[model samples]
Target: MSPIIENFEKSVNTLLLVSTLVATVTFAGAFTVPGGYNSPGKGFYIFVICDSIAMYSSIIAAVALIWAQLGDVTLLLDALHLAVPFLGVALSMMSMTFTAGLFLAVNKLR
Candidate 1:
Protein backbone atom coordinates (compact mmCIF):
# COMPACT_ATOMS: atom_id res chain seq x y z
CA MET A 1 0.00 0.00 0.00
CA SER A 2 1.02 3.64 -0.46
CA PRO A 3 2.50 5.62 2.43
CA ILE A 4 -0.46 8.00 2.34
CA ILE A 5 -2.93 5.19 2.81
CA GLU A 6 -0.84 3.76 5.60
CA ASN A 7 -0.81 7.11 7.37
CA PHE A 8 -4.54 7.49 6.91
CA GLU A 9 -5.16 4.11 8.44
CA LYS A 10 -3.01 4.93 11.45
CA SER A 11 -4.71 8.28 11.98
CA VAL A 12 -8.15 6.78 11.61
CA ASN A 13 -7.35 4.10 14.14
CA THR A 14 -6.03 6.62 16.65
CA LEU A 15 -8.97 8.96 16.24
CA LEU A 16 -11.46 6.12 16.51
CA LEU A 17 -9.86 5.07 19.78
CA VAL A 18 -10.04 8.60 21.16
CA SER A 19 -13.63 9.11 20.11
CA THR A 20 -14.64 5.84 21.70
CA LEU A 21 -12.94 6.76 24.95
CA VAL A 22 -14.61 10.18 25.06
CA ALA A 23 -18.00 8.64 24.40
CA THR A 24 -17.50 6.06 27.12
CA VAL A 25 -16.45 8.61 29.72
CA THR A 26 -19.30 10.98 28.91
CA PHE A 27 -21.83 8.14 28.92
CA ALA A 28 -20.67 7.18 32.38
CA GLY A 29 -20.85 10.80 33.50
CA ALA A 30 -24.52 10.96 32.58
CA PHE A 31 -25.38 8.24 35.07
CA THR A 32 -23.39 9.41 38.09
CA VAL A 33 -24.16 13.10 38.05
CA PRO A 34 -22.35 15.34 40.43
CA GLY A 35 -24.32 16.53 43.49
CA GLY A 36 -26.98 13.94 42.67
CA TYR A 37 -30.18 14.45 40.69
CA ASN A 38 -32.27 15.47 43.68
CA SER A 39 -30.87 19.02 43.70
CA PRO A 40 -30.76 20.34 40.20
CA GLY A 41 -28.93 23.60 39.56
CA LYS A 42 -27.39 25.64 36.75
CA GLY A 43 -24.10 23.81 37.01
CA PHE A 44 -25.85 20.47 36.92
CA TYR A 45 -27.73 21.52 33.82
CA ILE A 46 -24.56 22.68 32.16
CA PHE A 47 -22.96 19.36 32.92
CA VAL A 48 -25.84 17.54 31.31
CA ILE A 49 -25.82 19.65 28.16
CA CYS A 50 -22.09 19.53 27.76
CA ASP A 51 -21.95 15.83 28.47
CA SER A 52 -24.62 15.10 25.90
CA ILE A 53 -22.86 17.23 23.29
CA ALA A 54 -19.59 15.53 24.00
CA MET A 55 -21.08 12.09 23.77
CA TYR A 56 -22.93 12.72 20.54
CA SER A 57 -20.03 14.46 18.85
CA SER A 58 -17.66 11.67 19.76
CA ILE A 59 -20.09 9.10 18.45
CA ILE A 60 -20.34 11.03 15.21
CA ALA A 61 -16.58 11.24 14.99
CA ALA A 62 -16.34 7.51 15.54
CA VAL A 63 -18.78 6.89 12.72
CA ALA A 64 -16.91 9.16 10.37
CA LEU A 65 -13.61 7.53 11.18
CA ILE A 66 -15.20 4.16 10.55
CA TRP A 67 -16.09 5.37 7.10
CA ALA A 68 -12.45 6.25 6.57
CA GLN A 69 -11.58 2.61 7.19
CA LEU A 70 -13.27 1.70 3.92
CA GLY A 71 -10.65 1.22 1.22
CA ASP A 72 -11.32 4.32 -0.88
CA VAL A 73 -8.74 7.10 -0.76
CA THR A 74 -11.12 9.95 -1.47
CA LEU A 75 -13.63 8.63 1.02
CA LEU A 76 -10.91 8.20 3.62
CA LEU A 77 -9.74 11.78 3.16
CA ASP A 78 -13.26 13.16 3.28
CA ALA A 79 -14.15 11.17 6.35
CA LEU A 80 -10.93 12.19 8.07
CA HIS A 81 -11.72 15.83 7.40
CA LEU A 82 -15.20 15.43 8.82
CA ALA A 83 -14.15 13.43 11.86
CA VAL A 84 -11.38 15.75 13.07
CA PRO A 85 -13.60 18.70 13.88
CA PHE A 86 -16.16 16.53 15.62
CA LEU A 87 -13.42 14.95 17.67
CA GLY A 88 -12.17 18.38 18.66
CA VAL A 89 -15.66 19.45 19.64
CA ALA A 90 -16.09 16.30 21.64
CA LEU A 91 -12.85 16.90 23.55
CA SER A 92 -13.73 20.50 24.28
CA MET A 93 -17.24 19.67 25.45
CA MET A 94 -15.89 16.89 27.62
CA SER A 95 -13.66 19.45 29.32
CA MET A 96 -16.63 21.72 29.85
CA THR A 97 -18.59 18.84 31.32
CA PHE A 98 -15.79 18.08 33.74
CA THR A 99 -15.53 21.71 34.78
CA ALA A 100 -19.24 22.05 35.29
CA GLY A 101 -19.38 18.83 37.25
CA LEU A 102 -16.52 19.94 39.42
CA PHE A 103 -18.21 23.25 40.10
CA LEU A 104 -21.42 21.53 41.08
CA ALA A 105 -19.66 19.11 43.36
CA VAL A 106 -17.61 21.78 45.06
CA ASN A 107 -20.60 24.01 45.56
CA LYS A 108 -22.41 21.11 47.14
CA LEU A 109 -19.54 20.52 49.55
CA ARG A 110 -19.57 24.14 50.58
Candidate 2:
Protein backbone atom coordinates (compact mmCIF):
# COMPACT_ATOMS: atom_id res chain seq x y z
CA MET A 1 0.00 0.00 0.00
CA SER A 2 2.86 2.33 -0.70
CA PRO A 3 2.46 5.27 -3.04
CA ILE A 4 4.37 3.51 -5.81
CA ILE A 5 2.20 0.43 -5.62
CA GLU A 6 -0.89 2.58 -5.61
CA ASN A 7 0.29 4.40 -8.70
CA PHE A 8 1.06 1.11 -10.39
CA GLU A 9 -2.41 -0.11 -9.65
CA LYS A 10 -3.87 3.01 -11.21
CA SER A 11 -1.87 2.48 -14.37
CA VAL A 12 -2.86 -1.16 -14.52
CA ASN A 13 -6.48 -0.23 -14.16
CA THR A 14 -6.17 2.20 -17.03
CA LEU A 15 -4.53 -0.46 -19.18
CA LEU A 16 -7.25 -2.92 -18.31
CA LEU A 17 -9.90 -0.45 -19.39
CA VAL A 18 -8.14 0.25 -22.66
CA SER A 19 -7.48 -3.41 -23.44
CA THR A 20 -11.08 -4.31 -22.72
CA LEU A 21 -12.30 -1.56 -25.04
CA VAL A 22 -10.03 -2.80 -27.80
CA ALA A 23 -11.28 -6.34 -27.35
CA THR A 24 -14.87 -5.16 -27.53
CA VAL A 25 -14.25 -3.19 -30.70
CA THR A 26 -12.40 -6.04 -32.38
CA PHE A 27 -15.11 -8.49 -31.35
CA ALA A 28 -17.67 -6.25 -32.99
CA GLY A 29 -15.50 -5.89 -36.07
CA ALA A 30 -15.36 -9.63 -36.43
CA PHE A 31 -19.09 -9.78 -37.00
CA THR A 32 -19.07 -7.01 -39.58
CA VAL A 33 -16.32 -7.74 -42.03
CA PRO A 34 -15.30 -4.95 -44.37
CA GLY A 35 -17.44 -4.29 -47.46
CA GLY A 36 -19.69 -7.27 -46.77
CA TYR A 37 -22.72 -5.04 -46.44
CA ASN A 38 -22.13 -3.36 -49.77
CA SER A 39 -20.33 -5.66 -52.16
CA PRO A 40 -18.01 -8.62 -52.37
CA GLY A 41 -14.65 -7.72 -50.92
CA LYS A 42 -11.07 -8.91 -51.04
CA GLY A 43 -10.10 -7.52 -47.68
CA PHE A 44 -11.90 -10.07 -45.56
CA TYR A 45 -8.63 -11.82 -44.83
CA ILE A 46 -7.02 -8.60 -43.71
CA PHE A 47 -10.02 -7.79 -41.52
CA VAL A 48 -9.97 -11.24 -39.98
CA ILE A 49 -6.24 -11.11 -39.37
CA CYS A 50 -6.42 -7.72 -37.75
CA ASP A 51 -9.42 -8.65 -35.67
CA SER A 52 -7.72 -11.81 -34.50
CA ILE A 53 -4.58 -9.95 -33.56
CA ALA A 54 -6.51 -7.23 -31.77
CA MET A 55 -8.79 -9.63 -29.95
CA TYR A 56 -6.01 -11.93 -28.83
CA SER A 57 -3.66 -9.16 -27.81
CA SER A 58 -6.33 -7.46 -25.77
CA ILE A 59 -7.22 -10.75 -24.14
CA ILE A 60 -3.56 -11.36 -23.39
CA ALA A 61 -3.27 -7.95 -21.79
CA ALA A 62 -6.32 -8.60 -19.65
CA VAL A 63 -5.01 -11.97 -18.55
CA ALA A 64 -1.64 -10.48 -17.72
CA LEU A 65 -3.33 -7.82 -15.64
CA ILE A 66 -5.40 -10.38 -13.80
CA TRP A 67 -2.37 -12.52 -13.19
CA ALA A 68 -0.39 -9.58 -11.95
CA GLN A 69 -3.04 -8.87 -9.33
CA LEU A 70 -2.61 -12.28 -7.78
CA GLY A 71 1.13 -12.30 -7.28
CA ASP A 72 4.02 -10.32 -5.87
CA VAL A 73 3.78 -6.55 -6.03
CA THR A 74 6.50 -6.46 -8.64
CA LEU A 75 4.54 -8.71 -10.94
CA LEU A 76 2.30 -5.90 -12.10
CA LEU A 77 5.10 -4.02 -13.76
CA ASP A 78 6.43 -7.14 -15.38
CA ALA A 79 3.00 -8.09 -16.69
CA LEU A 80 2.41 -4.68 -18.17
CA HIS A 81 5.84 -4.64 -19.71
CA LEU A 82 5.29 -8.03 -21.26
CA ALA A 83 1.90 -6.98 -22.57
CA VAL A 84 3.42 -4.06 -24.46
CA PRO A 85 4.55 -6.23 -27.34
CA PHE A 86 1.07 -7.60 -27.80
CA LEU A 87 -0.36 -4.12 -27.90
CA GLY A 88 2.27 -3.11 -30.43
CA VAL A 89 1.39 -6.00 -32.64
CA ALA A 90 -2.30 -5.22 -32.38
CA LEU A 91 -1.70 -1.61 -33.34
CA SER A 92 0.36 -2.55 -36.39
CA MET A 93 -2.19 -5.07 -37.50
CA MET A 94 -5.00 -2.58 -37.11
CA SER A 95 -3.10 -0.11 -39.25
CA MET A 96 -2.49 -2.73 -41.89
CA THR A 97 -6.16 -3.60 -41.87
CA PHE A 98 -7.09 -0.03 -42.59
CA THR A 99 -4.52 0.22 -45.33
CA ALA A 100 -5.84 -2.94 -46.89
CA GLY A 101 -9.36 -1.60 -46.82
CA LEU A 102 -8.25 1.63 -48.40
CA PHE A 103 -6.39 -0.21 -51.10
CA LEU A 104 -9.47 -2.28 -51.83
CA ALA A 105 -11.56 0.87 -52.15
CA VAL A 106 -9.07 2.42 -54.56
CA ASN A 107 -9.03 -0.73 -56.62
CA LYS A 108 -12.79 -0.94 -56.71
CA LEU A 109 -13.10 2.65 -57.84
CA ARG A 110 -10.63 2.15 -60.66
Candidate 3:
Protein backbone atom coordinates (compact mmCIF):
# COMPACT_ATOMS: atom_id res chain seq x y z
CA MET A 1 0.00 0.00 0.00
CA SER A 2 1.09 3.56 -0.54
CA PRO A 3 2.03 5.93 2.28
CA ILE A 4 -1.28 7.75 1.87
CA ILE A 5 -3.29 4.54 2.18
CA GLU A 6 -1.24 3.55 5.21
CA ASN A 7 -1.88 6.89 6.84
CA PHE A 8 -5.59 6.66 6.09
CA GLU A 9 -5.76 3.22 7.64
CA LYS A 10 -4.02 4.48 10.74
CA SER A 11 -6.44 7.37 10.99
CA VAL A 12 -9.42 5.06 10.55
CA ASN A 13 -8.04 2.73 13.21
CA THR A 14 -7.66 5.63 15.62
CA LEU A 15 -11.22 6.75 14.94
CA LEU A 16 -12.50 3.26 15.61
CA LEU A 17 -10.55 3.04 18.84
CA VAL A 18 -11.87 6.36 20.10
CA SER A 19 -15.40 5.47 19.00
CA THR A 20 -15.22 2.19 20.89
CA LEU A 21 -14.17 4.02 24.01
CA VAL A 22 -17.06 6.45 23.64
CA ALA A 23 -19.54 3.63 23.16
CA THR A 24 -18.23 1.89 26.25
CA VAL A 25 -18.45 5.03 28.34
CA THR A 26 -21.91 6.00 27.13
CA PHE A 27 -23.28 2.48 27.57
CA ALA A 28 -21.84 2.41 31.07
CA GLY A 29 -23.46 5.73 31.82
CA ALA A 30 -26.88 4.33 30.91
CA PHE A 31 -26.69 2.23 34.04
CA THR A 32 -25.43 5.02 36.27
CA VAL A 33 -28.14 7.63 35.89
CA PRO A 34 -28.16 10.75 38.01
CA GLY A 35 -30.31 11.16 41.17
CA GLY A 36 -31.02 7.42 41.22
CA TYR A 37 -34.58 8.05 40.06
CA ASN A 38 -36.06 7.02 43.39
CA SER A 39 -38.50 9.91 43.11
CA PRO A 40 -38.60 9.90 39.33
CA GLY A 41 -38.73 13.60 38.57
CA LYS A 42 -39.01 15.06 35.09
CA GLY A 43 -35.31 15.89 35.02
CA PHE A 44 -34.40 12.37 36.02
CA TYR A 45 -36.59 10.99 33.26
CA ILE A 46 -34.98 13.32 30.76
CA PHE A 47 -31.57 12.22 31.90
CA VAL A 48 -32.50 8.60 31.38
CA ILE A 49 -33.87 9.37 27.93
CA CYS A 50 -30.74 11.26 26.98
CA ASP A 51 -28.55 8.43 28.23
CA SER A 52 -30.56 5.97 26.18
CA ILE A 53 -30.21 8.05 23.06
CA ALA A 54 -26.52 8.47 23.64
CA MET A 55 -26.07 4.75 24.16
CA TYR A 56 -27.93 3.85 20.97
CA SER A 57 -26.10 6.53 19.00
CA SER A 58 -22.79 5.27 20.27
CA ILE A 59 -23.73 1.76 19.23
CA ILE A 60 -24.51 2.98 15.72
CA ALA A 61 -21.23 4.88 15.66
CA ALA A 62 -19.36 1.68 16.50
CA VAL A 63 -21.14 -0.13 13.67
CA ALA A 64 -20.30 2.69 11.33
CA LEU A 65 -16.67 2.56 12.39
CA ILE A 66 -16.53 -1.13 11.59
CA TRP A 67 -18.32 -0.51 8.33
CA ALA A 68 -15.80 2.17 7.43
CA GLN A 69 -12.94 -0.27 7.97
CA LEU A 70 -14.37 -2.82 5.57
CA GLY A 71 -14.49 -2.70 1.74
CA ASP A 72 -13.14 -0.18 -0.79
CA VAL A 73 -12.97 3.61 -0.79
CA THR A 74 -16.50 4.06 -2.10
CA LEU A 75 -17.89 1.71 0.52
CA LEU A 76 -15.93 3.45 3.24
CA LEU A 77 -17.21 6.80 2.14
CA ASP A 78 -20.80 5.56 2.19
CA ALA A 79 -20.37 4.10 5.65
CA LEU A 80 -18.85 7.29 6.99
CA HIS A 81 -21.68 9.27 5.46
CA LEU A 82 -24.15 7.16 7.39
CA ALA A 83 -22.19 7.89 10.52
CA VAL A 84 -22.99 11.59 10.21
CA PRO A 85 -26.55 11.10 11.48
CA PHE A 86 -25.27 8.99 14.34
CA LEU A 87 -22.87 11.79 15.12
CA GLY A 88 -25.75 14.24 15.19
CA VAL A 89 -27.69 11.97 17.51
CA ALA A 90 -24.71 11.81 19.84
CA LEU A 91 -24.37 15.58 19.80
CA SER A 92 -28.06 16.06 20.56
CA MET A 93 -27.81 13.63 23.44
CA MET A 94 -24.92 15.59 24.88
CA SER A 95 -26.97 18.74 24.62
CA MET A 96 -29.89 17.01 26.31
CA THR A 97 -27.60 15.87 29.09
CA PHE A 98 -26.53 19.43 29.71
CA THR A 99 -30.13 20.56 29.83
CA ALA A 100 -31.00 17.75 32.20
CA GLY A 101 -28.10 18.69 34.45
CA LEU A 102 -29.30 22.26 34.60
CA PHE A 103 -32.80 21.08 35.38
CA LEU A 104 -31.50 18.90 38.19
CA ALA A 105 -29.45 21.74 39.62
CA VAL A 106 -32.38 24.07 39.64
CA ASN A 107 -34.70 21.51 41.20
CA LYS A 108 -32.15 20.82 43.89
CA LEU A 109 -32.24 24.40 45.01
CA ARG A 110 -36.02 24.46 45.03
Listed per model in order, the count of residue pairs whose N, CA or C atoms clash below 3 Å is 0, 0, 0
| lDDT score for candidate 1 against the true structure | 0.95
lDDT of 2 by residue, 1-110 (tens): 79988888888887778777777877887776656655555576666777788789888988888777775887888998977677677667667766766665566563
lDDT of 3 by residue, 1-110 (tens): 67776676676676667556666766776666655557488888888788678767867876886877875777666766776578668767867876885677567663
The deviation in Å at residue 68 for candidate 3 is 1.5
lDDT: worst 10-residue window of model 1: 101-110
**Best model number under lDDT:** 1
Clashing pairs in 2: none
Candidate 1 clash pair list: none
Once superposed on the true structure, which residue ranges of model 3 sit more than 4 Å away at CA?
Answer: 1-11
Q: What is the lDDT of candidate 3?
A: 0.71
- TM-score, candidate number 2: 0.78
Ten contiguous residues minimizing lDDT sum, candidate 2:
33-42
- Model 2's alpha-carbon lDDT is 0.75
The true-versus-predicted C-alpha distance at residue 3 of model 2, in Å, is 1.8
Candidate 2 Cα misplacement greater than 4 A, ranges = 37-42, 102-107
